[model samples]
Target: MRERVGVYPGTFDPVTNGHLDVIQRAARLLDRLAVGVAINAGKGPVFPLEERVELVRAETAPIAAATGCAISVVPFEGLLVTFAREQGAEMIVRGLRAVSDFDYEYQMAGMNHRLDPGVETVFLTASETNQFISSRFVKEIARLGGDISSFVPQLTLERTLARVRDQAGE
Candidate 1:
């Protein structure tokens, strides 16, 4: 059987537990997985692309080690479908938090299909505990001095808080 390569693309402003859940799940399903840190300048991410990729790499290391799934964190710009094709990924894994995410993801899936008919998209529902957690919300909570340790990994939370403090000149 051919190795199944999958791409999970996201901005990953901060590597949250919810994102980790999806990564763990997808890692088990594919022979190899690539976490693509999208360079979305439009979103104005709090963490730079390099930092985002490093955070994801740190958080996902154990998952990859335990599952024996080859994984790499990479930065990509331009169309997701194009990136997936370039990575030789046959599947694009996405995490769906709720019904609200479906419409946008569904449309993107269709567009990806049109762009590359060979690559398929698979959506994994976020774990119940992580369903309400999002990077944006976590960042908001951190910026407002709320505890966000439960939502994000320890290292990620530390780095995010440090960055926030630095930006505030604290």
Candidate 2:
């Protein structure tokens, strides 16, 4: 049987808990999961591509080991559908936190389908505890010296705060 590989692509500026929740849930449904770190120059991410990739790898390691899922963190640029096809991903995993997210995701899903009819898009609703958590809000809170430990992993929170501090010349 062919291996079921899925790609979960995101900027993952600091790898929030909500992102990890989706990763963990998706890992169980697929034989392999590749967390694709998007290298979008336009997004102007606070964390560099490599840092984002490393953070995701570190955070997902335990879950990957526990689930026996071949989870890999990779950096990609350009079209997501193209990346998915190159990685041999049969599906693209997306997380929907609420009805607000569905409209945008639904449009993207349709575009991705048009790009590659063979690949499917799967949406996983965010867990109740993490439903409102987002990387943008987490970063904003951290930059303002608010505790973001609850929104992101401990390691990620530390790294984000340290980076923010460094940027501020602290």
Estimate the TM-score of every prediction: 0.98, 0.98
Backbone clash tally (model 1): 0
Q: Pairing residues by index, what is the TM-score of model 2? A: 0.98
lDDT of each: 0.94, 0.94
RMSD of each: 0.8, 0.9
lDDT, candidate 1, 20-73, per-residue tens? 999999999999999999999899899989889889999999999999999999
Where does model 2 exceed 4 Å of error? none
**The 10-residue segment with the lowest total lDDT in model 1:** 161-170
Question: How does residue 112 of candidate 1 score in lDDT?
Answer: 95
- Candidate 2 accuracy as lDDT: 0.94
**What digit string (tens of lDDT, one per residue) describes model 2 on residues 19-138?**
999999999999999999999879789999989999999999999999899999999999999999888998999999999999999999999999899999999999999999999899
Worst lDDT 10-window in candidate 2: 40-49
